[model samples]
Target chain A: MDETDRLIINSLQGNFPICDRPYLEVAQQLGISEDELLSRLQTMLDNRTLTRFGPMYDIQKLGGSFSLCAIRVPAERFEEVTEIVNAFPEVAHNYERDHEFNMWYVLATESPEQITHTNQAIEARTGLKVYNMPKIQEFFVGLHFQA
Target chain B: MDELDRKIITATQAGLPLVKKPYAALAEQLGIDSETVKQRLRNMLDKGQIRRIGAVPNHYKLGYMANAMSVWNVPDDKIKELGNQLGALPFVSHCYERPRFLPEWPYNLFAMLHGKSREEVADKVQQVVKLLGEYCVGYELLYSKQILKKTGLRLKAKD
Candidate 1:
């Protein structure tokens, strides 16, 4: 990652003030023109250097509940199970980890009850147990990778 | 749900200014008042549309030397209680319970613990084990060698 990539990654985490010319303001900080800043961000997204560029809402604070869930999907059913799990809007990220419980995903819902409901639905749909692992405690909240 | 909300998210996600009156600057480009931008952000936060708006430092650069994904085998009945207790720990950054891939894997609860060194992480795991006692049947610790990606969702196009 070059200087621009580093700058973009660093600024992406925090609150961007509500303003008319936010990019221009951001440009001023980078000592670049607003057009250049906007164009570079567009390019970064297009290249997939940035997986996503959006607001990361604190679900817990918003009266919703979310948990990290996983299942030991059979090797044969990996692709099938992944489709079913990823179908839910609540399942934000689904990954195949190198572990016994290979398939892992995140479920964020409006309430604790919803979490259970979603788990049951997933179990029924996939014929696999949805290990509902709600956060016991929060040790670290954010993970920002260096560009 | 509204167009402005969408625009604000798009703008912020794309990148925010690193200057004074950043909100005002955004407002100028978007042709809206800075206060409007601020209010929308506040609303998005309250509504759970966004988790947080803050700087996410690169831990490796900061020298947070050790990080591991720890899994525990706790009874279904007590999983919640244990998870809650573990999540509350200062060193535990990421915690969740997943189904045990029995016969192949037996652990259920998982936590991401970070420290300045491998020994520090091991020490914290010991602390967790002590707190949970017999409830924790067994555990394994997987350290992270690399971080592929750590950005928020776009909430559009992917669907």
Candidate 2:
């Protein structure tokens, strides 16, 4: 929540040019040295101030398909179910929500057919129905958090 | 388009450094020149491999108390028009349409609305309903109480 943290947050939300010395370019814009900027980022990551730093792809546009799926995993078997679902490389993220459909996750695959196959495999592995919710329309895309 | 580009994307997904010469530092890590790092980033932005390079915060921590995932059932034909209109709204955050999981659900288009409270989020939904008009057959709202994981994408490197 310091001035430096705010700057880092703001800079992350904005467009970063794909240049050779992109960090240096960002540093110049913020009037800082490239080495200093890099060190701060490393510190942030090491300290868990930032969870991750990477690209977010438009999987649909990339000819891959994805769905938001949920399952009513009983408390007794939650851990077992989590393991089964998380085993797939396609399961991008999984979460435990406070609802009957407590186990929720996202699966991105090369095709819609893959989505169905993956769901069936999950059901067979866990004996729970995987509610496959594929996006029907896009209402909003980007989420930029102002620090 | 090469191994270096993939590495750079993986390295700087969260946010760039906050120093005077962040690129120089990145170059040092990648064993490349600062100029090389800078140019690659510019290219990635142009190619849409990376969307933006900025801080993504935990909204719950920011006092935005309520966030709801609102799903709508719009006729297939009017989906694009309604999506564009809804996407323009300031309150809508993450929006997309998914295939209908029948028997239990029929909604399609989904938009996330965040506000200071549940009532505030409801007001935003009311605004969306007004804008969407009668074309919306049904809608459901799902509130998020916990966020398990929110992270950036990692590009697979070519061998």
Best by the DockQ measure: 2
Deviation (Å) of A141 in candidate 2: 1.3
Q: How many clashing pairs in candidate 1? A: 37
In angstroms, the error of model 1 at A43 is 2.0
The prediction achieving the highest TM-score against the true structure is: 2
lDDT string for model 2 (A3-90, tens) is 8766876676666555546677777888878787677766666766655444454435434677899898898998788788888887
Please list the residue runs of candidate 2 whose C-alpha ends up more than 4 Å from where it truly belongs after superposition.
A1-12, A16-65, A72-80, A87-89, A97-102, A108-117, A136-139, A144-147, B147-152, B156-159
Best by lDDT: 2
DockQ each candidate and list the results: 0.19, 0.40
| Residue B115 alpha-carbon offset, candidate 1, angstroms | 14
Q: What's the TM-score of every candidate structure?
A: 0.57, 0.76
Give the C-alpha miss distance for residue A62 in model 1, angstroms: 3.1
CA lDDT of B73 in candidate 2?
A: 90
